[model samples]
Target: MKVTLPDGTELQLEEGATGGDAALAIGEGLARAALAVSVNGELRDLARPLPDGAQLSIITGKSPEALELIRHDTAHVLAAAVMELWPGVKISIGPAIENGFYYDFDFPEDAEVSDADFERIETKMREHVKAKESFTRQDISVQEAIEKFKTENQDYKVELIEDLITNEGAETVSLYTNGPFTDLCRGPHATDTGKIKAFKLTSIAGAYWRGDAKRQMLTRIYGTAFLSKEDLAEHLHMIEEAKKRDHRRLGKQLDLFHFSEISPGSPFWHPNGMKIWNSLHELWTEQNARRGYNRVKTPILLDVDLWKISGHWDKYRDNMYFTDIEDRPMGIKPMNCPAHIQIYKSERRSYRDLPIRYSEDGLVHRHEPSGTLHGLMRVRHITQDDAHIFCTEEQIQDEVIQCLRFGFYIYEIFGFEPKLELSTRPEQRVGDDATWDRAEAALENALQAEGLEYELNPGDGAFYGPKIDLHMKDSLGRSWQLGTVQLDFSMPERFELAYTGDDNDEHRPVMIHRALFGSFERFIGILIEHYGGEFPLWLAPVQAKIIPVSDLFNDYADQVAQTLVDAGLRPDVDARTESVGKKIREAELSKAPVMLVVGAEERDAGTVSVRRRHNAGDDDAKLTIGELVDVLSAEVAERRRPDAG
Candidate 1:
């Protein structure tokens, strides 16, 4: 038989030779380093036999496939260590995740794993790695696998195998063995345990067997592994940095927002936080005005009939919050599209009035699971920067491009390079294939025309249409999805929305639903983390802090603040009976972008000392009032879009 290597080299080998044999034929060095092989793009273990006249690529320790194998082997080691420490603990399943691996187990009633057990587990894992036990894969019939797990009293394993056999029509299952430990898995694990050189168990938590709340709770042990010690240290440091910038902590320190038991997933905006909100809203309104969008308001609660007509009742009912209003069902709007459709249908339109862009700061409520709610990232009640564009089918591409450009403009203001994603229709979508195909093609063309690269997320779109998702990466390299543009043919058809064409015939107008800032609460949360509570000059709640050096400068400080306020800036005067140094330190702690120091000399001279928030080691610069305003105005404008360059 002939085998082809990645470099197009062909070697004649015995028919049905294993990948290991092929590697050995290539070179002794490759054979020793080979962890797995990809035969015709399918990853398989070295023990798997290669077909006749096959193309193969041997994967070594440096390849991503080899890294996955190492992580999988580490999970098996972890499970083995747990079972060894506490006899009678039943292993369920272990899988390799993006960053690391985790193993779930159902331990004995009296035995519960905690942080203290991590050191012992780590020691056991290292011992296994040092032993260099080879991983062996075995294939057995479903009935045999079930019987083996049942006999061992491993109910979770048995249950999983039974489901796979019944639902997936599996005739056989694969199991991996290392020394005395065995786990049910479909794997291409590392050649041996020695490959797991740098790994650490990070934390422990409780998880459901299959993520169902009512299912049996299992102990999930999480850990991460890297190819080298230095890489592991760097990863750990990145995690520490992310912890320091966690928005929940910064929100409290900055006094921006808070949550209470009365409203579990809702945010209470304080004065400072509301100031930021108002500024964002003002900017939004100003931008939309330039884009020819008409600002509109709609009812927060709508009757069930409206939702039914818009198809929200059928598709999005699970996430919607409904109430009984005088014995009539009313839903707190979970989205603004249906309400926008209602407004569109309120008036008859002609081709002259085509392409109506309606904008609203719509407050919505969705019933999110309690476990999924985070500080401000995930919440129940949110105000969406919602807009709907109603236009003829021919206008789809241009409208989409315009929306993308608008989204780019918004993200660029925060110094974020937006990542784009195109989501196609789901299996249970409403539109016909022709409509979906057209819509998807239009979105793709628009994105390509704008020269934006995007990832395709199959079957992740709304039921009504395909969508474009825009994500922003923060300082810690975490991506947040904050903008979306969805194309909808279903809503217009369902609502029977039509605009007269040039031929005087009524035709259904396509609808495009879009939001630049997905939710006010979540975006603010991201901004807090992105800027570490030191918002840009334009977005800062208090752009400037006027610090009076002494009580003698109170009137001057108040006048300075008034001048700033009159100049369309949010400024505050600190008149507390405190030392100048203390006031400056407090201003820095509050993350005020600019601190204007007013002393008797500066008061008399109509000048002030300017201190930058992030300049911890810099001296203050003295400037006249006009000069100060000019510098601050530039800073504020730059904060609006410092990355425009």
Candidate 2:
């Protein structure tokens, strides 16, 4: 039999030769370094044999695939350690994630793992790694696997295997063995335990099986692995940076917002926080107005009948928040498309009025699971910067392109280079084959016309449509999905939305649902983290702080602050009886973009000592009050985002 290498070279090998044998045939060095093989693009263990003539790419320790193998192996090691110490714990599933891996286990009644057990587990894992135990893969029949796990009293493993066999009709299952530990898993693990050069168990949390809250909760241990110690240290440093910029902590310190148990996924915006919200809304309103979008407001609660007509009640009832109005079922709007359709249906339209764009900062309520809720990132009540465009089928591409351009403008203001993604039909989608194909093609052409590269995320689109998702990178190099443009053929049909065509016949108008910033709450959270709470001059709640050098200068400070406020800046006067240095320190800590020092001399000269946030100079430059306002206004008008570069 012949095996093909990545470079397209073919080697004649013995029939049923494993990947390791092929590697050894190539060279001794290659065989020693080979960790796994990508058999025709599918990763497999070194022990897996090539079937007939096949293309294979050997993975080494330096490859990303090899790193994933190491992390997966580390998870098995950690699970083995846990079972060794506890003796009766049942292992469920362990899988490698983006930064690391996690293993879930069902513990004994009296034995619960905690932070204190992490040290012992880590020690045991290291011992296993040092022992260099080879991972052996074994295949067993479904019945045999079930019997084995049932005999060992591993109910979770047995249940998992049974479900797989029942649902997927899996005839045989694979198990990996290392030392005294064995786990049910698929192939593509490291060649041996010695490949796990560096690893650390980060933390443990309670997770329900398959994330269903009603199911029995299991202990999930999270850990990370790297090829070298230095890489591990760098990853740890990046984690520290993320921790330092955690928006929840910054939100509290800045008096921005808070969450309460009564409203698990809702936020209460404080005065300072509301300022930020208002600023963003004002910008949104002004931009949409310029873009030919008519600002509109709709009812927050609508009759369930409207939702039924719009297909929301049937499709998204699980996430919709329902209320009772005089015994009639009413739902808090979870999206703005239904209401926008109502507006479009309110009037008879002709071909001349074909593209009707309606924009609104719509407040939506969704009943997110309590466990999935985060600070402000994931919330129940949110105000979406949403719009819907009613256009003819011919206008789809142009409308989509315009929406993409608008999204780019918004992201560019925040110094973000947007990443685009084209999401196709989901499993539970509503459109017919031809309509879906046309809609997907329209989105693809729009992206191509704009000359933008995008990833195709299969089966992640809205139920009603395919969508283009826009993501932006932040200062910490983390990406956030902010904008989306969805092409909806189902909603208009469901709502019976129609317009008179040029042929004088009524035709269905295609609806394009878009949101530049998915939700104000989540976007604000991302902005907080992106800027590390040091918002740009335009977005800062308080752009400037006026500090009085002494009690004698309090009046001057107040006057300066009032002048700045009248000039369209959010300024605050610090009249507290603190030292000038303390006041300056407070302003710096608050991340105010500019600080104005008012003293007897400056008050008499009608000038102020201006200290810029990004400046490192020790000297404070003196500028006239009018000149200062001009400088500050220019900075704000420029709409410079935080230094993402």
Compared with the true structure, what per-residue lDDT tens digits does model 1 show for residues 1-645? 998988998989887799999999999999988888899988888988898777899988788776667788899999989989999998888888988899998889999689789999999888898999989999999999989999999999998898998899999999999877998999887678887779989889999989888988999999988778888888888888778778899888888889998999999998999988987898799899999899999998999998998777987899998899899999889988888888888989998897999999999999899989999999999999999999987899999999999998888778776899999999988879998899999999999999999999999998889999999887777888889999988888888899989998989999999999998888888888888787888888888999998999999989888878877888899999999889989999888888999898898899999887767698989998888878777766555543342
Model 2, span 1-645: residue lDDT tens: 998988989989999899999999999999989889888889998998888788988899877687778889999999989989998898999998889999999999999679888999999999999999999999999899899999999998888898898899999999999999988898668789998889998889999998899999999999999888998988888888889889999999999999998778899999989988888888898899999899999999999999988778877899998889899999999998888888887889998997999999999999899979999999999999999999998899999999999998888888776888999999988878898898899999999999999999999998888999898888777888889898888888888888988899999999998998899999999888888888988889989899988999998888888888899999998899999989888899999888999988898999999997867567899999999999889877777654632
Candidate 1 off by > 4 Å: 3-11, 24-33, 53-55, 60-67, 108-112, 140-172, 208-217, 640-645
TM-scores of the candidates in the order shown: 0.92, 0.92
After best superposition, candidate 2 residue 39: deviation in angstroms? 2.2
Q: Judge candidate 1 at residue 578 and give its lDDT.
A: 96
Which stretch of 10 consecutive residues in model 2 shows the poorest summed lDDT?
636-645
TM-score of model number 1 = 0.92
* Whole-model Cα lDDT of every candidate shown, in order: 0.88, 0.89
